[model samples]
Target: MSRHPRLAAVAIATAALAVLAAGPVSAGEPTVSDPRIVAHFDFDAGQTPENIALEPDGSADLTFAFAHQVARVTRAGATTVLATLPAVANPQTPNIGAAITTGIARAHDGTLYVGYATGTAENGIWRIAPDGGAPEQIAQLPADAFPNGLALDERCGTLYTADSARGVVWRVPLDGDAPAVWATGAALRPTAALPFGANGLKIHDGAVWVSNTARGTLLRVPFAEDRTAGPIETRATGLEGVDDFAFTGHGDTVLAALNTPNKLELVRHDGTHKTVLTAADGLDNPTSVAVRAKTVHVPSAAYFDTTAPDPNLLLARISRNKL
Candidate 1:
């Protein structure tokens, strides 16, 4: 999702700690009440945590392309490797150069859908059986078309992919069919397709909410029925390098990872937005955010030195009294 300008700059500087302190804290900043560090994983020894997917069983699956493996971190804090991806089919082509899995989602049937960008021309979708088998490529995307984000509409059995290169949203039917362009345009292409760009996505109610990193905007498009809608409705803007987001337990409140300042933001579905946490709140290069129960889990990745220590990705519990 490097298309966004703001995120491109952040990606260049992997020192997540430095970026978070670049700005000052203000009273208007999003309030993170009773924030505490619930869990911490040190990637300094080479466990680069990329994206996180939570299972119904309360286990957190952390994916890392550096290790070509997915680690299951149980709610009890024990970590285990769930699976390892195979080498790219072709190593010479830029499209299929390296097998870098970026996004992941689990279907209602327990099928795991993983999206990866082969350094070569071959980027596509893959499915891993619930019982755990080899990942099978389901669809091959176009050359230079990197699939960066994945969101599943379980009710409709539809999968959405954010094609950062083409600045388009793609829909793939779970029943196995050709993928179609669900949405496209310059507005969709917030930046060049870098971090925090169009990297976060989710389908809620009858619409798709996308985080526009370059413009620092969150966009909402009408559901499948309004696939041909003229333009997306701007839900919120002025955010700083907004990356991935997850809905709160109530589904109406959202917590977003702000990449630039390394903060977590809380956005109300009704259009109210606030910075809930800042550098003081202990987030570093907060790339993705997910909420389970009352806990907001954030994953901070250090992009510069793959060997540098990854920050203690915080899991803050939302105060029941505040909301």
Candidate 2:
């Protein structure tokens, strides 16, 4: 389940309608097409997909949020459990209620790196090889920290994790070095109303781009020539409840998941954005998004879905039109 407090369903539905009604649709703007549910998960059994990473073969690797397991779903809707995380003696997680496996990233060699927030000694990042077995903890994050979004920069041999509770990003070296604080500031901090911050992490255009769920902003931390942190920049704003995002092949244009309202937005490079997908299109609190060539993948956890609880993955083709 998501860490943020759930808003009333009526409120979310109303907000979703407002956005959809105002969303712009014109020539040269990218819109979602052929949106369909590729996989339906057992929401009652804790199989909520919190994040996703795409495989080269059109399959998707997902972190089942409450199940504490990683699984793969093929294009034909076949499912396979890749690895199951160990159960914590005490399942109580800080800020959030229970332990969960959140963000995920797949390496070139088919290895999977995932964030596990057990709120116990086991809290950290875990790695699973291609020939999956037991996952090994590569980095031990703070027990109280909630590691949510993850991104891999194979160029720097680093794995960046967004700590939602700490409002900071951790730089975990793939070469076994200790994980250290990568970036933090006011923009990353949470609020009294929203408890989560730094919800998504991605390395794009030589910079680390992150979304702040509480602050409703997307920030950019450019890397210096020496690979140090450059001045922080706010790329987009007014994106409350935004979770994970992926860049379209068109430069810095992005497809971002707006969780609570069950919507997805096409965010342009100039900070302007418009809703492109909505609840009517089968989004049940979409948690993350991934773009693989012309394909867009969105996984809905349905954390706030009480009416007809159905946690599923939706796939759609990204319109070739340049935005």
Query: Would you estimate the TM-scores of all the predictions?
Result: 0.80, 0.92
The TM-score obtained by model 2 is 0.92
Error of 2 at 75 (Å): 0.7
On a 0 to 1 TM-score scale, where does candidate 1 land against the true structure?
0.80
Off by over 4 Å in 2: 1-27
lDDT of 2 by residue, 1-323 (tens): 33332322223333322222234554576667889998999987889899999999999999998888999999888999999998887754667657899999999999999999878888989999999999999998888788889999887799999988888889999999999988888888776656677889899999989998877778999999987778789998878578899998778888899888788988887778888889999999898999887789999998887677789999999976665
Highest-scoring model, TM-score: 2
lDDT string, candidate 1, 3-76, tens digits: 21112355543332212222333333333466655456655333546567888876777666445566677666
In model 1, which runs have C-alpha deviations exceeding 4 angstroms?
1-46, 89-99, 119-122, 192-196, 224-230, 270-272, 304-308, 321-323
Largest lDDT belongs to which candidate? 2
What local lDDT score does residue 168 receive in model 1, on the 0 to 100 scale? 71
